[model samples]
Target: MTTRRFFIKTTSLASAALFVKPGALHFKDAHIGLQLYTVRNAMGKDPAGTLAKVASIGYNSVEGATYTGTENFYGLDAKSFAALLKQNGLIMPSSHYRLGEDQENGKDLMGTILHDWDKAVDDAKTAGIKYMVCAWLSPAERGNADHYKLLAERLNKAGETCAKAGIQLCYHNHDFEFTQDNGQLPYDILLSHADKNLVKFELDLYWVNKAGHDPVALFNANPGRFPLWHVKDMDNTPQHAFTEVGNGVIDFKTIFKGADKAGLKYFFVEQDITPGDPFISITKSIDYIKKNLI
Candidate 1:
């Protein structure tokens, strides 16, 4: 009767033992991006309008979250999506796509489940996306260290596939990967076992902090492994709920100082749950990032 929440709590306790001192702050001008998932509702309603608003908010880059079974970018074909981004003055460098494990109940019958994978990669290339990320892991896909090992193998294969198409493959982590399984963290297994040349990571800052792990320590342990990041913040509440970037307690300034060490290439602002209008929330977050962190 062990629930995912219980497992997360236990893992938090386990990760608390490993903490490092905050490093010095270093600032650099980097292209600000947004994960389209934050405004998914709006995007679903009007992809063009949503992206236009996002661009008007000063986000020069974006990471897509609407590539599931459609193999299309927000209902638009690859070429059309690319054109739309150009019209909005935005560039898409990366996107989130569910892995094979989380799709079709982990089945691979005649490759129908992932039949659109090649086309997806091709479309991403056409759309100028440099990274194709495995966005999440199903509860069933994560059982133990062995399961993670198998998942890592799948990641490597996926990475190889993307590599052939001139794109990099990355895994996006949630709090679950930070938890331990038989004293071995799934994150460690994926980082240590996954092929470094083919597989990278897109670190979500808020989830890593919630898991009681230090992002700096992770960067120190595995240098140049993280090329992308989800720039979200956490409030001061006991739950550490999502908040606007500068409004939260997370020390993003110190974290960004280690961007070089983390091998950061692009970062996207993503507030999973906002209080009011998502556009206003993102605007405030981006303004804060420009003024303070980035």
Candidate 2:
């Protein structure tokens, strides 16, 4: 992983612009999606109210991040949660579910981490979700290149299961995947080994940039593999911490220009750590997207 200090000092604005191909960009009917993790604190306290606020802020879609041990969305059952989203005029096309090593303790492969995934898929179908995403990997889950290969296999199986229920499985990445293990990037390994028809990627732009890589280059390399993206930004500071979308140094305009090649279907704004009120942060981000990126 690139150190924050090095990134802040070395990342060049001119180089980022040079990476974008000159072309006219247009996103027809594309709406902004919010990753609920941005307001995890608010959602934990009041999911309904938080969603209402999100809707009012012009977010037409959402991607859930609170569907782990509960099996339910936040505190509501799948049906009720879907209803809540409808009430606010918001639709959730995707949700983040943790994927880990299947503890072979008499349980099916993914059954250990994603309890009752079949049922979760069924519920997601009912909620009108099209994608079930593996949100993150723990330090233990990603040990080396071999571990990523094994994870790709697991993802293929999971994607097959979801496909039976008309859902796609995707892996959302962080900066860690870009780090090399034995001179091979875990991201490249997964992309190479995973069944392309079954599994896809949800690229997090900020983390990719933080890792000292180019998003447009990845899109050019594996066209149509990345259908989802986390549209977060990196502050132009020593910490390179999470900040409101357009407030940071990331050139989203340059990246969005290649959305077609990236296979971008849905993108969610996610600021992992807000400088102040999260709602305020997200509002600023969406405003910027509306005026600039979208």
Candidate 3:
């Protein structure tokens, strides 16, 4: 980690490739990846079958949305799950976890960064996951600026744990992160206060735009800090709802132009709510990407 950090900070940017993880795919050559939450219903029904369908749709990579609840991928243990993905010709580079601070409500979320982080990291290693993302916060988790500051410290600690295991720790943001709390933007507070070497970000494009922020400007302000992205688009309507990739107003062509500057390693297409069959919607997104974005 130290060596990679030094290389990124140095003038000889040409040496970057030497630091890439073995078997890792760069942004442009990367196969289209998906956030499994986009197909949560199907995943809950049949994880193995759902992964096969996702691979059939041209998604060779995926970001996991569960693990905190069961400490396993769907019903399979870490090693078993990895075999399942391999059989389907898929890779899971990242997964999401909650804060796990809500255990008082009968939520025995033991596979969380806060609860049994080492076990989580061990399982992530076994599953061949390279990144772990703090996915989301419930309403009760949101708090004032002080709360965010505290959260930053906790994230840095979690990031250190991940680093020790050769996994990068990232935080996924929503529109609420940009909302002013205690006279300060919570997102800005995190950016300024978090340990940059320890914690990076996975920018969710739709949520960032929904919060009235420009993704490019944010990338410019914090170059190389963002390596992962959620590529969901917003519709050109009064409601500005979620839509398929090329069927919306995101201007991915423009946004993708900043991929190199943003240190992009991988991006996943996600739509929280689809009109009908999610497989059809994902097929539309991948088709658009293949035809236009690449």
Clashes of each: 0, 0, 0
Pairs clashing within candidate 1: none
* lDDT tens per residue, model 2, 1-294: 975334322322111111222552334334578999989999999999999999888787899987766677888888999899989878899998877454335644442234577877888888889989998887868889998898998889889889999999999999999999889999999999999989999999999999999999999999989989999999999999999999989999889989889888888999988978999999899888765753
Name the regions of candidate 1 deviating beyond 4 angstroms: 1-29, 102-115
Q: Model 1 reaches what TM-score against the true structure?
A: 0.87
Which candidate leads the pack in TM-score? 3
Cand. 1 Cα-lDDT: 0.82
Q: What ranking emerges by lDDT with the best candidate at the front?
A: 3, 2, 1
Clashing pairs in 3: none
Per-model lDDT: 0.82, 0.83, 0.85
Which parts of model 2 are misplaced by more than 4 Å? Answer: 1-28, 102-114
What TM-score, to 2 decimals, does candidate 2 have? 0.88
Residue-wise C-alpha lDDT for candidate 3, range 114-138, written one tens digit per residue: 7999999999999999889999987
Write down the TM-score of every candidate: 0.87, 0.88, 0.89
User: How many residue pairs of model 3 clash at the backbone?
Assistant: 0
Give the residue spans of candidate 3 off by over 4 A. 1-29
RMSD of each: 11.2, 9.2, 7.7
**lDDT winner among the candidates?**
3
